[model samples]
Target: MTASSYPVLPDERLAAGVARLAVRHQGRYSVETVQRLIADSYEQLAANAHVRTHLVVLAERFAAERLDALAHIESPTGGERPRVLFVCSHNAGRSQMAAALLAHRAGDDVIVSSAGTHPSGAVDPHVVQALTEAGVALDEVYPKPLTDEIVQAADIVITMGCGDACPVVPGHRYLDWPVPDPDGAPIAVVRSIRDALDARITALLDTLPGA
Candidate 1:
């Protein structure tokens, strides 16, 4: 089959995302570099038969996540704090909210991360709005696939609705929050989920080693 079946088109959304990531890169690299990275990231998942659409949006997040990881691989905060990994059915809603809330509340006290057992094309719009309304910045995050390394690196792993999809790693602290998946849910429902997560995060913070 020819590559024509899988064309990489740079539309307005993709360009806008590239621009945002370029700014986030702090001029360390040119916009061209960031855009290329995003294109490459998109191609990484485009081959997956399961990923039918949303290639542009997923590329933006995957590229940003990869770049952010590269930016901090050698930083001093790499392993200084407790690392928490939030896993959900799709890393778009509950887990995203949890990480955002914890990161906001705990700041540098916790290294917060999130992923999906079955990754989604994008984050839930309602969840984004709820967190944005609650004052948690969601621009820097995108849904990502859960990997063994991320799970192993985390001091704590909280599962939302992933059930058996979430891996069980030895010596890794685990908690399963019975929070509803807010995908396609109404705004009020998303807000309730966000509030519940905020409370749970508050309690979780109290149990951390340094909290």
Candidate 2:
């Protein structure tokens, strides 16, 4: 009846090793029960990259649960729509593109977010240009670190190239798209990346609920 019973714990150091798990989740974890569950999940699945990834997913679920408990929060209730997260190593290129593309295409129907494993301070200008050329406004996009709350908030976590650096949470789906980095690439290449992502996002949209 607890998160600890789910699996065996990993070494404590692994928790520090896998730090790029969350995106921008703002949920607070003050409850002893929630902490226990997180710790238990972390310990049980410490050695498994996939299990750790599930832990990241669990973080999002917890965030949703926390939000549901708040009477003043304006977030939609469960099953209204699913949250999606896009992750890359820098949060500067591919992940940013994918997140923006999804948000643009999906609009308010889906919650979308993006982050980097080793996040740069700002998005790549080339990425900005590519998105702009693709017709998605780029004025409000900013680079952010991967965080536990963000991971916990997402129903889907898309990893670009972070591999094991991302975390795992149970009961969530994951997708990995091997998109190339467009930081310094020529406009042609950036456009290619954009087109590829657009196709992928279209396909992904087909999988979302009520799509």
Best by lDDT: 1
Q: Could you tell me every candidate's TM-score relative to the true structure? A: 0.68, 0.64
lDDT of 2 by residue, 46-148 (tens): 3223224344454434333333323223453666677888998878899999989998999889878887777665677788898998889764555555666
Worst 10 residues of 2 by lDDT: 17-26
**What is the model-wide C-alpha lDDT for candidate 1?**
0.78
Model 2 deviation from the true structure expressed as Cα RMSD, one decimal place: 10.6
| Candidate 1 deviant stretches above 4 angstroms | 1-79
Model 1 Cα lDDT, one tens digit per residue, 70-98: 55542436336788889998788999999
The runs of at least 3 residues in candidate 2 whose Cα sits more than 4 Å from the true structure, single-residue gaps closed, are 1-76
